[model samples]
Target: MVHTQEYESLLPTKNTKHSHRRRSFIIIILVTIAILLGTTLGLAYGFIYWKSRCIKTHKHVQLKHVLPGSFGIEFKLHTKNTSDTSTENDITIKWEHEPKDIRYRQKTEEMVSNDSVLTTVTIVNNNATVSYELGNETCWLNPDNSSIFEWYSILPLIMESVRSNHREDGCRERMWTTTYNGRRVFICIIDQRISYIRYDNRVAQSQEWMVPSQSSIKLPSDATKCGMMDSEMTSLLVVDDDKRQNTSDSTRQQLSYSQTYRKDNEYLKQPEIFVRSAKPDCLFIHGIGVKSPKTGYKSLKSMSYWGHIEKNTPQCSSHKFIQFNTVDNGWDSVSLHKMFCEFATGSNVDGRISNKIIFTHSMGNNIVAAALHRKVCSFDVQSSKWFSVSAPWRGSKVVLKLEDLCSGHLGPSHHKSENLLWLVLEHTKYCTHEGKMSPAYRTLHPTYKSPTGISYDDLVAVARLHVTGALCGTSPWGMGLSLSFSGTLKFIQSFSHLDQPNDGVVALNSCNVFGKKFQSIAKFALMSVNHLESSMKFGCRKPLCSWYQIL
Candidate 1:
């Protein structure tokens, strides 16, 4: 009985020892797993933080290294009157930035006007500062109305002038209203270029008017005066009543001539080499489908026809016309950039230096967008106006679909026997898939690389106009149909993925820049026009003529 008791006790101790060892092994495994998980999470977080720091540092370096050229100024007129009936025209503001010359001194008194209401001013002179004075407040303005300024329409022009003429020592200012000795007083002063603002007697009491940077202004419209008339010389001056009356009479004479020519049915004239204008220079860039004549290949003659029409128009007749030839096989943004940069730097065919206004169609729009984003063109020295028609700002689903079809060999087996069909399909694949590295696709893709280093706000420095075609009919028979059945089918198939109101070739939504949408100078939607007809139709010609007249 003593031996049996001892054996039972010894069995319990042995089993207990094994149990303790098993528990210790499990505890070690759990601790090891916890440490590994903690290490993985820490490494991931550290990598992300490092990447963010590099990006921030790169942006800081870019901004710090910006070369000074032209300076811009923003003027805000504040009234203490809290009344809701204040008119923006109640305060007359005038300013000028001019190089010291005889003509400038002579026009000084005429330029300083108290009768005009101007809220925003831009100083383009690299060497001179802008000067402004406010006129006596009128009864039409309520001192308490805080939103009486009409700065919305003219702010883009001011920002453009400043950006185009950026200078390190450029005078920048923000103005506001405050109470001085219980009376409403207006203040005009320069914004100090610093990290923070200190409100002293020199600044208005309201700190809200202080802008962080001169380039940070939010423009309400894209109608900029970058390459327009000289604001400093012409905008500030009020023309004499007699001179205005004479100008009105002359304008009527010109209108009468245009009306007579239209009534006589002599609108379409034979193509001729028209004399180039001395003032504004205009350049026309065709889309991807339009091959350059220089390539000695099948080219679209549509731009040439449009050129003839523009030359006949009264407004565009005097403006110089510049035609650019893009690559015939595939549209490339880098190639377009090189051509535009060369043209901007070189004198025109007429051997004259002038400002430019670019008109682009389809893929040409993407080319210009990429070039501007890359900052390849010297916009500060050669300002420009951009008009984009049927721009594929977003990548077209048609290209993606085509890529899949080519990759999958989904076409009819007989297509391999048809040489023409095979040739067309191969060319399409080459342009769309093989040319994926091209800047054109790079700009349109969702994962587009940002080359500008600057934000989309910087693009507002150039005036932009967008024109889209909508309300196209689903007509089965047209010139475009006879040329390529597969192409026509592709165009029809594109509508399935597109938003309503799309041109046969491009969707309206695809034409607009996503995320940072800049307000267009004008947006025109053409009704009852297909893709080909949009470029070839008669009604489409009229709006462009009108735009030229306004310019």
Candidate 2:
């Protein structure tokens, strides 16, 4: 009885027990508050670190982690690898990924392609020339755009996979087990520093966190000058991942010649901004009937031509323009091609020219097309792009309309529009080659000898020259005509001589479509614009859907 009473008293009184409970509850609340405060502080520190940290402490590359699990690759090629045999401008891209088609099973278990280096890229006259297995299939990139040859292109998927795995041991180990160009990669992180990016996957599979810095990283020396920002990188990730997930496997295989790279749906949602551009050294060639006080590429006089195209009209950041005057020579398209080859060959300040972007308006397209088809000009077809505006691929009937008006078929009584007099005067006076219409004007005729020396009736055969990036034609900004007065479209639309959809001077069929009718085409392909505005800048506003922007 005595032992039991002693033990019970020692246990506690009601007030004492209440006081002890209160103390315990206070301690628990304090501990929780401290933990939450610490967590908030840790997150803040992490955010700051992510915003400003280098891929290496030496700032070899800048990786700005803008979103959680979102990745970016900012190339900073400040150091020249004197130890390397390759030039500083050379960027050898080593890439590999999973097999495009699972059905195309590998002979070995590796599922790797036979080639390891996807491409060896070099800057030749400011254009990125890619030397790879698929040589001609590759397009030229502006050397200032470095997204393709960066490590972070493949990082988003790896980061997303790791982010999803809640049970990961915090080592943040990721392995691309499948082969890309005969190489499997292992990417791992230690002490929150990314390390161990090698084609061999053994170390990552083993989960050894102690990975030394990879010495094989090399980028083009001009990488630091690239224009694509972090938001663009995020957008690229979103678009690529979306296409990969949504498209059927068979469809994907059919769309691609070689699966250079691809991503799965596991990637986090990317931001809604993306851009790609090619602002190479541009050679602008003007169309027929270029009048006096001739606004060369320097004058910026004709918005109808590419005047102020790089800024006010078709905006791009870095493009070097060389304007060629249409009236500089009196030759036809065939003669112009030969003359152009000689001029282009000798015009090189550096004594060599390849991969120069050609910007043509009207008849210039045909002349350049002939030169390219005949291999007369030495433009690197594998890296060059041809952007033709107001291209009369099928030949316009409006030239006939002008010829009739000039020949007095439409008498002075019939022609009340003074624009008719202006056309006849300009075409005859400024653009005269013979007693009649100039050779440039004749080249615009549907039945004339084409620049290619082929019958213009076989328009498809003449229009079949291919470049790596061929940008063709532009839609007329629906407004007042460049040559004539108001209601000109209505006049041309009503004219017996002009029966088709005409852009005042060039018919729509001639400028863009060459008789192959489809129910749907890209919106950029659709013609005509602006019913309300009377602006005479009737050429295309911009090539918004160009491969430089949309692709």
lDDT of 1 by residue, 1-551 (tens): 99999999899899999999999999999999999999999999999999999877644442112312233322223321111111121111122223211100000111111222222222222111111222321101001111111132222222122111222222354322333222322333343221111122222122232213433332212221111012222111222323322223422443342233232112122112323354445565555543335422231223432334354334332333334444342333455565655555462122222355555666666655555555565443234345555565655554544343333232333221122222334332223334232223333443344454532333222224322211111211112211222223323333234454345445545654432232212222222223443333222223333333343
Residues 1-551 of candidate 2 have per-residue lDDT tens digits of: 99999879876786798999999999999999999999999999998887667334423322222122212121212211112111112212222222210010000010011212123344222233222212122111121122222232333333332221222343454332222323444444444444434432223122222222222332233221211112212110111222222213422332231112111110111111223244445556666655443432342333433423443324232444333445543324454555456545554122233555555656666666665555555555555545555566767675565444334332232222322332333332322423244445655667776444555534344444442222332112232112121222323323324433344456555655433321122211332322111121222222222322321
Least accurate 10 contiguous residues by lDDT in model 1: 101-110
Task: In angstroms, give how far residue 236 of model 2 lies from its true place.
Answer: 55
RMSD of 2: 25.4
Best by lDDT: 2
Task: Give the count of colliding residue pairs in each prediction.
Answer: 12, 3
> Using Cα atoms with residue i matched to residue i, what is each candidate's TM-score against the true structure?
0.35, 0.39
**Candidate 1 wrongly placed segments (more than 4 Å):** 1-279, 290-314, 318-332, 345-355, 378-384, 405-443, 450-496, 513-523, 537-551
For each of the candidates, the C-alpha root-mean-square deviation to the true structure, in angstroms, is 29.2, 25.4
